[model samples]
Target chain A: MAKVLMKGNEAIGEAAIRAGCRYFFGYPITPQSELPEYMSLHLPKAGGVFLQAESEIAAINMVYGASGSGARVMTGSSTPGIALKQEGISYIAGAQLPCVIVNMMRGGPGLGSIQPAQSDYNQSTRGGGGGDYRLLAYAPASVQEMVDYVQLAFDKADEYRNPVLVVGDGVIGQMMEPVEFRATAASDLPPKDWATTGTGGKRPPNIINSLYLDAEELERHNIHLAEKYNRIKENEQRWESVGLEGAELVIVAYGTTARIAKSAMENLNRQGKKIGLLRLITLWPFPEKGFAELDEATKDLLVVEMSMGQMVDDVRIVNEGKRGVHFVGRSGGVIPSTALVEEKILEILERSE
Target chain B: MVNERTILAGFGGQGVMLMGQLLTQAGMIEGKEVSWLPSYGPEMRGGTANCGVIVQTEPISSPVVEGNATSEIMMNTPSLDKFEKDLVPGGKLLINSSLISKKASRDDVEAYYIPSSDIANELGDTRIANMVMLGAFVELTGAVEPESIFQALESRLGLARAHLMDINKQAFARGAACVKEQRN
Candidate 1:
């Protein structure tokens, strides 16, 4: 297949289609509006359903309904829109429905800005909606990764019978890059026997519900969800480490911020500075194993993000104060330049010295 | 090229985004790594529109070229004023002299004053001014081959707009010629 130049948002839509996701219900939002637009134009041609829901809340409920019916389903929105869908997302998670949710994060708190941001890190990783649940969130750094991870998210969601989230900043949604959709191996997923496919009077009708009125039954349900989350945490921690060997400092970043950190690392390394980068691919699992393998010479860890400092807490938690944890971030749609990141790293190294 | 980070800035209708996309597409056709990032949203709706394009030999680290732009293609004066400082020292600056009156303020970077709009007007279409500027960029930087851009154009325009190919090619040649004439 020839590499085609495509926006990240469009690539995500194509990836979902190629992954056999036949149902897309989404409300349009900036930075991510292109994804739904692409779906609207292409999904029907691929023999799929693309419905523009009345609201984000309605869109997510549609996702829950579609996934519960044993269909590969997806929905996308930006930060504020994702907030509106939180209740539906919680319901889907609680019901253990297999679905994919794409959040092209924009600067936020409340309709903050239309530009790219990583402010949704905590919201995505720590469960934005209520309940004892953890979303298997993958934060993709590039357009190519967006394609690959969205496909992976579908498989993972089905395999675990849980909702999977692909979180990226607006840059990943807006930028255009050359991408070739390499073929992914189809996972040997188990049958959706629990799906609410109408029974043909051959067996008991499977009911998809999160409600367990009895306290003991609810506790058992919570325990089952916790065990599934633990298994995910154990098996799905993915990360990439660059130039970590004998490095003085390692920068922890994900999504578009990791790309900036890479550029900064390259520039500083050209100047003979020992800088490394740890890019998180899976944000929910948090990839603590990458930190454990850090070179002993690494004295400081810098958490770079597009938000004020959401991922910094996770870094500190994993680091356990063993290394000097620092944070450098920009909020409200401003991306930190490579030079600014280099300056921060130098400043941190100098202070440590 | 190790890395060529180019910023193409102009008003919304000036085809700056298309120019960036063309460069990126050409780079891709030539089997190089490329990325195009536009300053989107309201700025694209009649405000100053700009896009950052990176064409490089190695894998790109970031798609943004804010503080380390290796080249600036300014189609208007406001674009020149806004993006001139972003170009690194020894970078290349191509100003559309037909629209922008002032010369580049920086001395460290090599500046080319190409009246791209004028050249496109001579070629019978002002919309091809971006192609003219793009041609000058190709001649100046050799980031991607001129032939690669033609292939890119074929793929982008397809069969529907095939009639406009000749003028676009002419504008591109005129742009490269303008740079060659300046160098001589």
Candidate 2:
């Protein structure tokens, strides 16, 4: 495969196509408008279904309807737009349908800014919609990773019969990178025995609906999802560590901040600084074990984010006050520079010394 | 392994970000680790936009470049004003003379102001201006091989855009000539 320069959002759309995702429904939003735009152009050429739904509510519901038919369906939106679709997402989970959702997160509690931000961490992981449901969330920091995770998200969703979320920020959505894409197999997916493709000689007609109206049945469904979640924690935990040997300070971050933190560590290492990076690739099943393992040897721990201490709260919980934990963040869409990280690291070092 | 960092900045439509991407892709084709990060959110479409690209011979430890990159490309007067002091001392600077009237401030830096937009228009397309600047940078700094850059561009152009590859190839040659003429 040859490297092709592709925008992050467009790459997400193309990767879905290559992954045999034939149904797409989305509305327009900033920092991710290119996603729907690209889908509009390529989906038809690939003989796939593309719909410009009337609203995000309609878009997500359309995804639910398509995925019920056993097709790989997807929809993308930004933070605010995703919030509007949460109601439908809850329904999708209640039905236990396989689908893919992408949130190109932007800053804010309410229309804050279009800048990249990690403020949606808690909302994304803790079930933004309703009910006891957990969405497998994959956080990608770069354009190439964005493409990789889109394909992975579909595969995971189908495997678990649950929706998987690809959570990225505007930075990951808007940037460009050289990517070599693998073509998706159109017929390689497992047959959807549960799809409502009409019943002829089948044992029984398959029906997929969220309304159970039975307490015991709903409890069983919730327990089933919980079991799947536990299995995911054991098998799907993904993270990366750089320069962990003899490290004095450990920096924990995900998405764009993680990329910057890695750069700062390299620069610091050149200047004789003992620093390492623990980058979370799966933000939902937060790599709690990675940070919990840092005992007395790790002098300082820093959680870098593009929000007002959203993921930092998780880092602190995992640390359990065993070591000094600090946070460095920038809100409302401003990405912190490497110099700011260096200053923060140096400050921690000074305090430790 | 040397990590070649660059920050290209200009007004919204000056093609500064495109030049950054072109260089990054060229580096990637050469089997180098590369990343292209552009300004997003509020500054992307309307306000000033910039892109940071880091290319290294080894696995890239970090994708972000702190302070200033080893090279800087400015396309407008405002961009020169904003990024003049950010260039690494004695680093390479390429300006679009047709758009950027003011030159970089640091004398320690090697600066060249080419009429990239004018040359591109003469070559029959204004969009190729970024490619011209890309070519000039390769010739002036030898940061990347000129042939590799063209091949990278052609591959990235894809089947949908194979017709425009000739224009890009020509634009690269013109920019390279512009740099050689100055060197002589």
Candidate 3:
């Protein structure tokens, strides 16, 4: 296929449109502003609706409204802006709506900086908003994956009847890549029988709300979500393990950070260093099984990340403290050097031997 | 397989971003995994434009290329000041002799002070200087097939540009020939 050069943010907008996502509501934010801008220009031309909501909160609710009416909908924001949409995200998850929310993450505790950072790892994987809900999160390392995941996110959301988050760092959102536009029809996805599309006279008015006054009703809802989550754990865990066997150390990373670690690992391996990389493609559901094997393979493990020490904590848990899990990270938008990562790996290998 | 990483930097109009994109697309066409990452900043406000391209046999995990140990930097003056120290040992340094009069200070990194702008001007448009550097990059590093690169460019360029395709092909050919002539 002839690959067309496209920016990561614009590719997401195009992918969503091609995937039968006709309704897009979003507010502008740096590193991700191109997404809404692209949608504003392309959606109307594609015979779709593109609304620039007043705020992140309003944009997410607009997504909620559109998704409720059985339309494939999406909204995008940066870290701080995404934080504002949490209340709405929780509501979407609670109501079991199928929609895609893109968090082109930036450095932050509160508007920290516009540079890309994976500090939102905990916020995204755990609970960014509030509730016993889990967003099926996909971390895209490349622009191609960024585009492909938008379609995948929509499909997964509809299949599970849940809100799926396409989480990416600012770098991923801003970078340009050569990508071939692949088309997939909306009808190719699962049917939306449960959607509140005016009930279609087959049933009465269906309510999509998170509030359940009765404890039993809430419990039932929780159980149902739990069952769905279990299925997600079983069938939805996506990961990539490189050179794990006969390795002395395993490095766990994801997204752009993981790609850098791969280079570092290759350089080290060429020098006769026994090293491997375990990359988590799906950030949510955490890929416990993938980490379990890495823990068993090598006593020395390194968790390199673009965050302070968030994903490193998960490495510690899966290692069960039996293996030495060391963390090497650069926070506040500073990407760790490959040499720095190599130095850490050499240090771990030396210590282990 | 030959693995190469380049950090091209200059002002926004230098077409550094396009060079990175062309190289990445070429790599992809040769059935290699490619990644292109831009310098993290506002692009249009006359800010310094920097971009990284990784062309390799294996999948690229990280797009962020560091200054230290970054081999083969194609820089234009101030960009050389910012990123030259990052070049790896035995890495070639290509400079725009037209715009960047002052050469690289480092002794360890091999420097090629090509009059890139003069060469681009002779070719009619300095915009494809990035493409010229990319042609040089492929010849020097052999990260992917040069034939594959021309093919990718031909197929990937938009229809609006169909009229100007032959000129670009010549530009890339000139770039490759320049490297060969230098070697001879």
- DockQ in order: 0.89, 0.58, 0.55
* C-alpha TM-scores of all predictions: 0.99, 0.91, 0.89
How far is B50's C-alpha from truth in model 1 (Å)? 0.6
lDDT of 1 by residue, A240-280 (tens): 99999999999999999999999999999999999999999
Best candidate, DockQ-wise? 1
lDDT of 2 by residue, A1-353 (tens): 88777888999999999888998999999988999999999998999989999999999999999999899999999999999999999999888889999999898988778888889999888877889888889998877788888998898888878899998888788877778886654535566788888888757889998886899998898898899889888888788887777789999998988988887888799999999899999987878767655645688888899988888777878877877889998888888887888899999999999
Pairs of residues clashing in candidate 2: A18-A184
Where is model 2 more than 4 Å wrong at Cα? A182-191, A292-295, B40-49, B117-131, B153-184
DockQ of 2: 0.58
Give the Å shift of residue A229 in candidate 3.
Answer: 2.8
Residues B1-108 of candidate 3 have per-residue lDDT tens digits of 746778888888877777777777778777777777888665575568888887877666566666633455464778888888878877777777778889778898
Candidate 1 residue pairs in backbone clash: none
lDDT of 2 at B120: 92
Task: Tell me each candidate's RMSD, in Å, in order.
Answer: 1.0, 3.0, 3.0
- Residue runs of model 3 more than 4 Å from their true location after superposition: A1-4, A178-190, A199-202, A295-297, B67-75, B119-184
What TM-score does the A-chain of candidate 2 achieve? 0.96
Identify the leading candidate in terms of TM-score.
1
